[model samples]
Target: MNADHADDSLLICRTLGGCPDATRARATGLDADGMDFAVAVAGIEVPVRIPFARRISERAEIRQEVVRMYEQACDALGVPPRSAERNSRSRPGLK
Candidate 1:
């Protein structure tokens, strides 16, 4: 389910602060939902769509599992611990 703007502020900030190669922040205007803010991430308008607690829990579980798997793989392959997180996110279905 979608979230109220207040509950999704941190997420919005993070999304805005992500690796935007070079894009102007334009006040394009309200979307169908009348949101006051929006961004075109990698060419898609991803406004705040915070999931319910259950979904958040499930995502956390998936993240932990992925981190564990990546850590194990890194240890087995003797890669650095600092780099496992990147690999974890790169794994399919983790995002």
Candidate 2:
């Protein structure tokens, strides 16, 4: 696998915590490989809100606009947005 594929596999494994070779397995329809690819394309939406002094007010509006745009694009592509789990089990201080 190429670097990008490896990265996606790593992310899939990290997030889903399934069989290590599941991502490498062949995709026979909507299986692990297909789901990995889809998730790589349309990842879980984690809303980010950064506070900057100059554009504080504008940032909120821009953030909403961008989120709306992303939702519209996902709708057009027929892929649903994956919501983040309330409890993340990943190591703290890690991205």
Candidate 3:
């Protein structure tokens, strides 16, 4: 990831709890409008593009958008948001 996309990438990873799937996922590209993820589905690395509803010009908007996306994904999967306690517990050496 480049400097321009580092923050957004971090936000996306954290909100999604690393990745939605375990198949060698990565934030391959990002722009002011959207992001591209390289994920392996069925042993094939596919490029998935997620576009923003509106152009995001500032870094502050990243968190909100990531959270919204994460929540939507969780709802779609019929799972609850990963709680702070669970997150902390799951991470090694975290208190």
Candidate 4:
């Protein structure tokens, strides 16, 4: 299911804001049935595709699935997940 432009703003903002290296206010223009946004990860601009969905429930489900898929892809690529990195840095007694 493809989501229209109006439906995905919150997810976009949240996703962008969560990363320290993200472009902050930059998002690529829409193409086809999806839109691309870039976030700086490990000093690299990583493009994330946001798909369209017709309803909020579908969007919610899509968000969960997308997160799961992204984690899997990171594992396959031998890249660390963002949360792991963030948490590692935040704990006081661990260097």
Using lDDT as the measure, the top candidate is 3
Where does candidate 4 have its weakest 10-residue lDDT segment? 1-10
Could you tell which candidate, 1 or 3, scores higher by TM-score?
3
Model 2 worst lDDT run, 10 consecutive residues: 25-34
Instruction: Encode model 3's per-residue lDDT on 5-95: one tens digit a residue.
Output: 4333433443343444434446776678877776555577777677765788898886666667655554554555455336542421111
* Preferred candidate (TM-score higher): 2 or 3: 3
Name the top TM-score candidate.
Answer: 3
Tens-place lDDT digits, model 2, residues 1-94 = 2342333233333333333232232111222112222222134422222222233244345444334433443344344533332365342211
- CA lDDT of every candidate: 0.34, 0.32, 0.54, 0.44
Which candidate do you rate higher for lDDT, 1 or 2?
1
Predicted candidate 1 versus true structure: per-residue lDDT over 24-65, tens digit per residue = 222233222222334445666644322222322343464443
Q: Sort all candidates by lDDT, best to worst.
A: 3, 4, 1, 2
Measured on C-alpha atoms, candidate 2 has an lDDT of 0.32
TM-score of 1: 0.26
TM-score attained by model 3: 0.60
True lDDT of residue 76, candidate 2: 45
